[model samples]
Target: MSSENDWNEDLCGCMNDGGTCLYGFCCTPCLFGANAEKISEKNCCLMCCLYLVLGSVYLCWVPHYFERQKLREKYNLKSNPSCGDCPTTLLCSPCALCQEARELKARESVQRSALKANNNQPVVSQPEANSGEADHVNMRV
Candidate 1:
């Protein structure tokens, strides 16, 4: 192979000529062609993208599995992806929207409790009584 014919074994899997690989399209053939560098670069780029997506899925989503029991014990977090938008199963950050929603719900619950407490109280109409007395006094004047 020439110095410019550097091909990635992983990218193409096995390439016979200087063309694209039949098995692994991400790999470049390193046998001939002046565009060997470009082809190799393209192959490397494809491999990089593949690795990136795989890594993202594995690292981001897979970790939650490893900590499945622990998360469940701690936060009642389960690993069921079908558990309807819970943070433990989701790959996205839960502290953003989920936490915000939980906080908002808690706030609304507190407000509701406060409203219930206020409703339980007996409201006195001192202003109305005072206004009626003022009107009566004005009539006398």
Candidate 2:
């Protein structure tokens, strides 16, 4: 789990980022599933289907709520006021999904930058003994 925090962006900020919001809005199921997959490493197709299927009953928020809660726990995000997870997901699923997508994007960017920084860093090799081998072996593909 990550450290305690609030959502990177508010749920209502769905349109704040531009085309990602548009993509999320246009493909709500896909966004929901992809966001869920990012949080749980589960098959996005299942998530997508869940949204499409359960959506008819207007209760797609059931699974979405659970996934949102899991996302909060995974990210150590403080639940929105008044036990906001279920409400946010339930009341406006698209907005919730968009928020989750933004969060995932932010996380991915952070990870990419960190990985790139590590790759750019000079590797400090330990002094090699007479074992005919270096202490560390780094092979870049």
Candidate 3:
């Protein structure tokens, strides 16, 4: 790892998340496309098709390589390879995709928890607000 932050999760740590790992393993194309879509790549289906076709020829690593680089750039993460992400994607495509999915999942949960925490607290100290309905808008009926 360089001065940049390491990836929050390990590549082989894919087993830590069963559903995502299974998804990455069984539907590698979908996983790749989805990861690309999350990082703002347009045409998720196109990406899926690309992965399908390229993967058949064992060249899917090409797109995954660039996608990984984009992800690294997006999050300021350190690339593990001195040669860059190419080798990692070339050698460990499934693990790479699983890692991406887990990263997205983990970040999403963290964000949701953060929002929940924030919503639970008041931004400023203030008197309780009263609904005037209790006083002037009463109906005796």
TM-scores of the candidates in the order shown: 0.27, 0.83, 0.77
- What would the TM-score be for candidate 3 when compared with the true structure? 0.77
Worst 10 residues of 3 by lDDT: 132-141
Ranking by TM-score: 2, 3, 1
Please provide, for model 2 over 47-102, each residue's C-alpha lDDT reduced to its tens digit, 9 standing for 90 to 100: 99989999988989999999998998888888877747777888888888888888
Sort the predicted structures by lDDT, highest score first: 3, 2, 1
TM-score head-to-head 2 vs 3, winner: 2
- Please write out the lDDT profile of model 3 over residues 1-141, one tens digit for every residue: 536867888888988999999999999999999999987665789999999999889999998988888888877888786545787899889998998888878777898999999999977976755777555546543
In candidate 3 the C-alpha lDDT for residue 94 amounts to 92
Residue 103's lDDT in candidate 3: 82
For model 1, give the 10-residue run with minimal summed lDDT: 28-37
Could you give me the TM-score of model 2 versus the true structure?
A: 0.83
The parts of candidate 3 lying over 4 Å away from their true place are 1-3, 81-83, 123-141
Give candidate 1's TM-score. Answer: 0.27
Candidate number achieving the greatest TM-score relative to the actual structure: 2
Error of 1 at 81 (Å): 31
RMSD of 1: 24.1
